[model samples]
Target: MLNFSNNKLNNEGRLRTVLDIGCGVASFGAYLLSSDIIAMSLAPNDVHQNQIQFALERGIPAYVGVLGTKRLPYPSRSFELAHCSRCRIDWLQRDGILLLELDRLLRPGGYFAYSSPEAYAQDEEDLRIWKQMSDLVGRMCWRIAAKRNQTVIWQKPLTNDCYMEREPGVQPPLCRSDDDPDAVWGVSMQACITLYSDYDQGVKGSGLTSWPARLTSPPPRLADFGYSNEMFQKDTELWRRRVESYWDLLSPKIESDTLRNLMDMKANLGSFGAALRRKDVWVMNVVPEDGPNTLKVIYDRGLIGTVHNWCESFSTYPRTYDLLHAWTVFSDIEKKGCSGEDLLLEIDRILRPRGFVIIRDKQAVIDFVKRYLVALHWETVATADSSIESDHDGDDIVLIIQKKLWLTSGSLKDTE
Candidate 1:
């Protein structure tokens, strides 16, 4: 209802990524898939009987999380839309911190579609809430894009003009100049607005292309990382060739329906996920927290990912991914003084039985992981040298392993 035509919403790809808070069963996300939109359905792991599990089983992208104290794992400007349909979140609590978090995630000129009683109800309490919400969003420089029936959509400002024009000493102040909006790994949520960068100040929106083109086009934010268009193109081509080789290696060992949910443990520029566009599987690209903040570049390319540190466990539930791709992840974490065995255990916890793992790293890391294969109930599928000819050092190895299906004593009796 934001006056968006079908062409604009579905074809133009202006609204590619979405954040669906309190998504129950993720039916809204499932519907958006036909329009080439991917929504990250988020819900809390509460007494609601594992709603996120049902969403995952339906092949919809979902995560078990809440808008709590910590920032969502994603980087700033990661989503083009944020939706809440009777999500029951108190947006006015704690100086509107939750709504501010949404502001951080949304791209400039992004929309928030809120559907709740406060928008339409005439009761006194509902009116009070509606007034408070309207004032809060107004202070945040969000304007009502559209309102109909019980739903109202608010659009964030396209630039920092409104923020700069705000009266001095506003309630929700702009974030400090030193604040890194992209630093989200285990970072606390701030009740402040993140001003646009100097580049964004001059631009209207995120300066990103549409979906298919965005998948291959060099993102404007690449300049923030000092990356040239040539480097981005080369990275894309490299992943394309590497993915082809990966499929060739996996073709014999797996059926067509084997790999559905995939993850890149250390996604760099999201080229790995972009290369797999033709495949039926969906990749959860993960950019390491310690590395360059490339998650924004990943989002600008229209791929989904999060900022994460391999030292700790991922935020999802156990047995979430069908295939895990670790390229230099073990070595990188090792250099950071994290335990490789602990990481291996965490991987085993997240990978489903019979799932696959592709680890491309130094021979030493492969040897270190191989030592725990038997104990982890995993078997080596295959090992090969680096397919890329540029690996003259010859230390790079591709090790593929599969988690074996096993039943514990506590579950064996139930099966019988």
Candidate 2:
């Protein structure tokens, strides 16, 4: 637990951001944010490396790479200061070149520092390594300004060299999971309800919390009564036709009619078949609702006592089918089979080992997470993905599950 108390540098910018050089289990970055950027350099030692869940929880961006790698990822003159925290001597020595990159990433007149606990320097070598860093910083126009028991602050002299031609921040682009099977797309199926429920959230990404005042009262959504899935099938084709009609509105400009025809077909499909993404935006947001009022007479009759959750809050349902578009509907049906054996198979395809998934039970569509999705696995945040319009009616079931993991490379012990 390192503490940051630099008033002089923190005072310069209206908002302050820092890069935690070797931030181990230490998320002080999320706790402190004056304004901008806070990321962890890509180091495998950090168990949570590439863990967007943690970063998203705190609104911080995560990235990969060792310091001083050829070009810095950020444009020159970006940060007011560069920070390194809880990194000791062994790691510091190997990352010596990284400090130069940090200095290079800093704004014209920025500061760099490293912090640790009171017992930060365990041995004489740790003190010697700090001296080595101090010397290097001095040669590069950085001068020591302040020092506490285990923290040292250094300032890089104001220079145009830092402003002229630095590359962008070494941050990776947003995770586009459709292309990568291993990486998560950050969207969920159950999460899509609230999105489409509204006329605007699907197209514009406005949250239900911000819906117009007049439309505050909730209404019948897709999952109120129970699971039929037939409705999803019908809506799929409807969305496809609508998208195809939309594409026809645009003039033809392609070289090949065959490709054009394919594009036309995909356009109707919606998610994968989506064309002109500008018109429709794919979305993901926190929490969801599977509405109960939208039920038909048959299943709605059985939904008497189960619609609500343990919390007993009628308004806190997790109802809403995100995207009712064709491609999403088809995929949901194709991939996620009904519970039991099919459920396990679908779960296998959708989740990685140790990866968790949120499932919506077809039986009782409750608004609160406590209703059903929790029994499967969703103890943490629920997950879903789709291209259909989402609704926030609070009727969707949240199924949380983690993929199973197994040990590999078992070996005999060396007892000799």
Candidate 3:
């Protein structure tokens, strides 16, 4: 069985909740409830009355309901975890309508554990189901925390993909409408039929609720670090358009026909990396250590980029990347309690000679960049106003710099 503690459901030092689907005998639910975890269990009314009674006797919430046919009686984003084992529910049926329901119930960064020790087989049928489950979750952007012989644990993404579904009437559709209920559950009747068919064919499984996984109130802002959670949270289309326009203008000025390697510093969920990816280039996303589970979210999306932490220097050797893009990294570093000098030196050390560094932030940040970086042997190439002004902050400035190279003793050296 999967361990909830290992998954760190209470990592933030708070109480957590879970749902136990197809909870046979209600033993698991009872145990979780006894352990101070709020556990809810769902089993069919006709078949599991005694088990439900046992769960209720133990103070575990128990209910009778058929998935697919009956909507789960819980508000969306209600659970920190959902678990199923040896039940007769087809999670992969109807292109994963059941899984989508779980997704709906799970808060962001929540977990789902499906256990079937006896179901493990090299048979084509079993393999087919496993592959389908993996692919479906992959598309849903759920992170596979573990894939043992009899179980698979997945963590829900921290944030929904921004451009997964583009604005309606905007050229080609980037993704199907995420908000459309039909897209998640499909035709309810057919889904029900499919669930029954799987159960009859011995390919079916099992159903639960929880507390909210977020803090009850906002934490204090980093007043000194030039960063605010509010700004990062307000990434509207207007902000995207401005960033896109900046990149479009910068692309032509870059000399490389096929920019080989790029790094995005403090790349929260990799929207910038996704935006900048091309046919030939490899983009790497580096996020802060406490970026609210950013690395896993990016990995789960299977975007065209590698994920790393900003606390460490780039693993690549000196002169490795063709370009480095850090839209708001300096400010993020300030907020994250890291030295800007360390980040800049690492960027310079990893970037190839004359490789570009691009950043965008407020004018105060731009001035700080000019002052600090010039002292560290960096050459300022260009600085321009992004013309995007915020009501509470100054107008954004786009600063571009290049690493300088001097040949000495048959090797490249950094020089003024």
Candidate 4:
């Protein structure tokens, strides 16, 4: 163990995000919630029929994904820890490419906790694997932080010193200078180390504050996007008012316990989810692939999200979210030569039956989506104008709708 304190984990809660690879039923993530840590539990839809499904059912954040040929739909350096416990992944396959993927996901000085037979088993095969994995991570500039029982924790270096000191012509070489670490959508996993930036190389860890403070304070990465603290504060205040108005519309329509899993389809700077911290819901903040790379900003704030393209389906099972928030997502995709109707269908597939959707966009877009409500089995709950007084355009609208709890003929025979 890392000898964490009673009140906080390492680095005064800077170590908040976790990537639990092959999380069976997400029990690890479930236990982490009590400690103010949020883990993005990932598993592929394979022999494990419904592991991610069960995790979502229990209100834990999860996604159906794997470290395969394609990159995981997340920006680089998003998690403080990457964990795999008896997950049955071949770390040494394809020249340790799978382990390199973890290296890309982890932040500077991040930790990877491996609990597998190779760590404790003494058989010949296990020993060979353990030796290879050890050498692979050693070349990748990772050191054993702790090893006990069946677990061996490795910590990534905080600077590029170890990498620069490596011998020439290493098997797994450094990524090309032109490679973008944050470019993950539809990208392939490369078998190379992603070096830290000039700023990150100087810092000890991610220049982030503690959890609650990090939530409100302007993150250090804001400067990377040329965003000012004033802008962050103004955005935060705007979302505060908008969320209050949203609760006013939703409070009367459903009970308090109705919503647990939520998704912000077009999260900008993640202010919307930040404003909802007091609620008992966990929001999957999504930043479009075409937009600014603010997913790192979202992570620095102690929140979780992924980089996605609305043109494609989200990486999750059907009926995974209890509520979906769309702030001009349909319009943004429309501008990209994508169909709004198809986006609506994808939304319907992910939203749970009887779930709620709040769409805020111009009047023309709202009218276009309204035409499909009947065919989609959704009913309008409320519609209102934007609360901002400066919106003199008089076309901005907020349309709230609820997905009907209807069943098809296939399930009609099911009766208790």
Each prediction's TM-score versus the true structure: 0.94, 0.35, 0.40, 0.95
lDDT of 2 by residue, 1-416 (tens): 21234643234322243455555433655554332223333332344444433432333333333333243323223344556665542423433445544654454345676675422566786667666666556555566667778877777555434322334432211113232111111211110001011322233311112111102112122233343456544544454444444334221321222121011101211222322222322211111112221211111111101121111121111211112111222223333452333333333332333443334332232233244333444333333322222432133333333333443345333332
* Model 1 per-residue lDDT tens digits across residues 328-382: 9998988999999899999998898999999999999999989999999999988
Segments of candidate 3 deviating more than 4 angstroms: 1-240, 256-258, 277-279, 304-309, 372-377, 388-394, 409-416
Q: After superposition, how far is residue 328 of candidate 3 from its true place, in Å?
A: 2.5
Best by TM-score: 4
Q: lDDT of each prediction vs. the true structure?
A: 0.88, 0.34, 0.56, 0.89
Best-to-worst TM-score order: 4, 1, 3, 2
lDDT of 4: 0.89
lDDT of 3 by residue, 21-76 (tens): 99866677666543345455777555554565455434344555558553454434
- lDDT against true structure, model 3: 0.56
lDDT per residue (tens digit) for residues 1-416 in model 4 = 87766646545677889999999999999988987888999886578737899999999999888668988877888899999999989889999999999999999999999999899867998888899999999999899999997799999999999999988998699999999988887899999999988878878668778888899899888888999999999888878888888888888788878999999998889999999898888999999888898998998888999988999998888998999999988889889999899999999999999999999889898999899999999999989887543333256799999999998877887752
Per-prediction backbone clash count: 0, 76, 8, 0
Candidate 2 residue spans exceeding 4 A from truth: 1-9, 12-15, 34-52, 67-72, 88-95, 116-122, 160-416
Question: Which 10 consecutive positions of candidate 1 have the poorest summed lDDT?
Answer: 386-395
Give the number of the best model, judged by lDDT.
Answer: 4
